[model samples]
Structures are given as C-alpha cells and as structure tokens.
Target: MKTTSIRELKHDTTAVMAMVANGESVEIRRRNVPVAVISPIPAKSPIERPNFRGRLKEIYGDALLTVTGTDLISEDRGDR
Candidate 1:
C-alpha cells in the first residue's frame, strides 16, 4: 500500500494512475487523515442469470411455496 496526499494525487494524476495500473493499492489522505483508496480493477467473471428459485429452495426447501401460498406476481397484483 502506498500513501499519498490529495494534493500529490492531484499534481501527479498520471503517475498515481500508473502505480494503480501496476497493481499497487494507493491510500489517499486529506489533511493527513486517510480518506480513500485506489486499486486495480479486478478481472470480471462471465455473467450469468442468478437462479432465484434454486436459492429459495436451498434456504426454505418445500416450505417456500406453502409459506407464500400465492405466486409473487398474483400477490403483487392483489385482487384485480
């Protein structure tokens, strides 16, 4: 971790960014107190749709349908 003042960061924006690009984490301080951090962007995983029903089954088993009684869409629509 590298510590830098806000003024230094402002003065040497490219250099600070270079350090971050090199995978170094920077601690930015304001008035001698730590205020923020700059770090390298993480590699992203392939996006996938979350399985909401599977997650609900894992958490509540068969009780989910029984507990909710009505489908979420119907419940949200009320007595239309």
Candidate 2:
C-alpha cells in the first residue's frame, strides 16, 4: 500500500497512476486523512495460451530428429 496527498496526486498524476498500474494500492489523502483508495483492476478476459505442441507436431509429423537444435545451429554456422 502507498499513500499520496491529493495535491501531490494532482501535480504528479502520471507517477501516481504508474504505481496503480504496477498493482499497488494507493491511499489518497487530504489534510493527512485518507479519503479514497485506488487499486489495479482485475484482468477481465481469459488468457490466450499458445498451441506449442500442436505447432511442433504440425512441423515435425511425429519423426524425432537425430540432432539437437543447438547442434543444427552450430552446423549451420560452421567457422563463421
């Protein structure tokens, strides 16, 4: 939790908002008494996860390769 004066909030709105954006609750104060509290809004939408396994299967078709990716890259960049 963080505390900020209303005058400070008005003067430095961007910095104050940045704190809220980074998931910190802020207590707004007037005359040294807390008047309002602000917090980051919960993410509303479902997360979109990537289909990595499907993509790999599509690219390779169940055939296991002999070489590691690192070895393949090293072979490609030989004496470079």
Candidate 3:
C-alpha cells in the first residue's frame, strides 16, 4: 500500500492506475489524512449448475390451475 496527496493523483493518474493494476493499493490523502483507497476490481466466479432447470421443473409441476367461471355462483338450494 502507498499514500499520495490529491495533488499527486491529479498530476499523474496513469501512474496511479498502474499501481492498482499491479495489485497494490493506493491511498489518496486530502491534507495529511487518508481520504480514499484505490484497488483493482475483483473478478466474479462463474456459476455452474448442471441440473438447475431440471430441479426447478421437478419442484413445480408444469400445470396451470384454473376454475370455470360458473363455479363462482352459489348452487340453487330450492330443490332441498
């Protein structure tokens, strides 16, 4: 890790970026205290699921639930 004043960062941004690419952290100072740190962004791991789709299909059946419109009306009770 290294520290640099804001003025130094503004003067030579290319050098600062080079340091980050080299896997070294650079701390930017405002007056005499550290204000921000710069480092290379970490890469994300690739996801691997061999049977993801099959597992989902097995969990939830491939069917849609439906009800006939007439089922909402009450059945006639006069015959009782």
Candidate 4:
C-alpha cells in the first residue's frame, strides 16, 4: 500500500497510476486523513448462463415433468 496526499496525487497522476498498475493499492489523503483508495481493476471471467433444465433434472430426476400436472399451466394462464 502507498499513501499520497491529494496535492501530490494531482501533481503526479501518472506516477500514482503506474503504482496501481503494478498491483499496488494507493491511499489518497485529504488534510492528512485518508479519503479514497485506488487499486488495479481485476480481469473479468467468462459468464455462464444457468441451465434450468439440467438443474431440474439433477434435483428431481424424471419426476419433475409429471409432478406438476397439466392443469397447472391452465391455472397459471387463468391468473393473467
């Protein structure tokens, strides 16, 4: 971690950024009191969409299909 005053940060913006880029956290101070922190942004990971069908199969096997009778669909549609 590195500490920099607000005035120093404003004067040497590039240097502060360089420190952060090297995976160092920076603490910004105002009037000698800490105000904010600057750190490197983490890389994002690939997102995976939820597989509802596979989840249902794992939870209930083949019984999920027939557990809710055909009338459930008709009852849900009636609410609309």
Candidate 5:
C-alpha cells in the first residue's frame, strides 16, 4: 500500500490508475488525513445451478395443488 496526497492524484490520474492495475493499493489523503483507497478488482465466485423443479417437488409434493386461500374480508358498500 502506498499513500498519495489528493493533489498528486489530481495532477497524475493515469499513474495512480496504472499502479492500481498492477496490484498496488493506493491511499488518497485529504487535509493530511487518509480519505480513500484504490485497489485491484476482486474476483467473483462461480454460482451453482439450482434444481428448481426437483426441489419444489421434494418440498411441496401433492400439498402444492391442494393448498388454497380463503378470503375473509367483506366488501364495504359505500354511497357514491
């Protein structure tokens, strides 16, 4: 990690970007205090494919078809 003032970052943006691309972390300071950090992009982990139909069948089975919702609220007839 390298500390760089905000002024230097503003003056040479390309150099800072290059450093970041080369796996170097950059610390930007403001008013003589550390403010921000620029680092390399993180890699994402691969996602596993889900068996939707099989999972649903295993979890719900025949109950999925028999389940029903009953409306309990009555409509209020108001005058226009």
Candidate 6:
C-alpha cells in the first residue's frame, strides 16, 4: 500500500490510477490523515459450469428412461 495526500492525489491522479491498475492499493490522505483507498477488482473465473445430465448422457450414450415413483413401488411389490 502507498499513501498519498489529497493534494498529491489530485495532481498525480493518473499515476495513482496506474498503480491501482497494476494491482497496488493506494491510500488517500487528507493533510497527512488516512481518508480513502483505491484498489483493483479481483479477476473472476472464466470457466462455465457444464450441464451434468447432458454430460452423463453424452458419456453413457443416452441410456436414460423416465420411470415414476409409483411404477418403481409396483415393480418392487411384484405379485405379493
């Protein structure tokens, strides 16, 4: 972190912004007292989340079939 007075910040705004752009934090001061700070926003991940169901079907060759809960229970009960 670097400290700069308000007067200096106003005069050297471009330089202060450059420091922030390069990932450095700049503390602004008023008459030698801390007042504000400037920093860069963190980078976000570029990866997109994949559709897992689609991926599963793709890898397993679309073996999925629809079956209801009642159907499952009847199948389990059998001739009992």
Candidate 6 local lDDT, 3-78, one digit each (tens)? 8888888898999999999999999989788899988999998999789988888887857558878999999999
lDDT, each prediction: 0.92, 0.96, 0.84, 0.91, 0.84, 0.89
* Model 2 misplaced regions, further than 4 Å: 45-80
RMSD of each: 8.7, 8.3, 8.4, 6.0, 7.2, 7.3
TM-score of 5: 0.53
TM-score order of candidates, best first?
6, 3, 2, 4, 1, 5
Candidate 4: residue pairs that collide: none
lDDT of 2 at 44: 90
Better of 1 and 5 by lDDT: 1
What TM-score number comes out for model 2?
A: 0.56
- Per residue, candidate 4 scores C-alpha lDDT tens digits across 8-42 of 99999999999999999999999989999999999
Error of 3 at 48 (Å): 1.8
Tens-digit lDDT track of model 2 for 1-52: 9999999999999999999999999999999999999999988998899999
Could you give me the TM-score of model 1 versus the true structure? 0.54
* lDDT pick, better of 3 and 4: 4
Q: In model 3, where do residues sit more than 4 Å from their true spots? A: 49-80
Cα lDDT of model 1 by residue, 16-45, tens digit: 999999999999999989999999999799
Candidate number achieving the greatest TM-score relative to the actual structure: 6
Return the TM-score for candidate 3, rounded to 2 decimals. Answer: 0.57
Q: What does the lDDT read for residue 30 in candidate 4?
A: 98
List residue ranges in candidate 4 displaced over 4 A. 46-80
Give lDDT: candidate 2, residue 14: 98
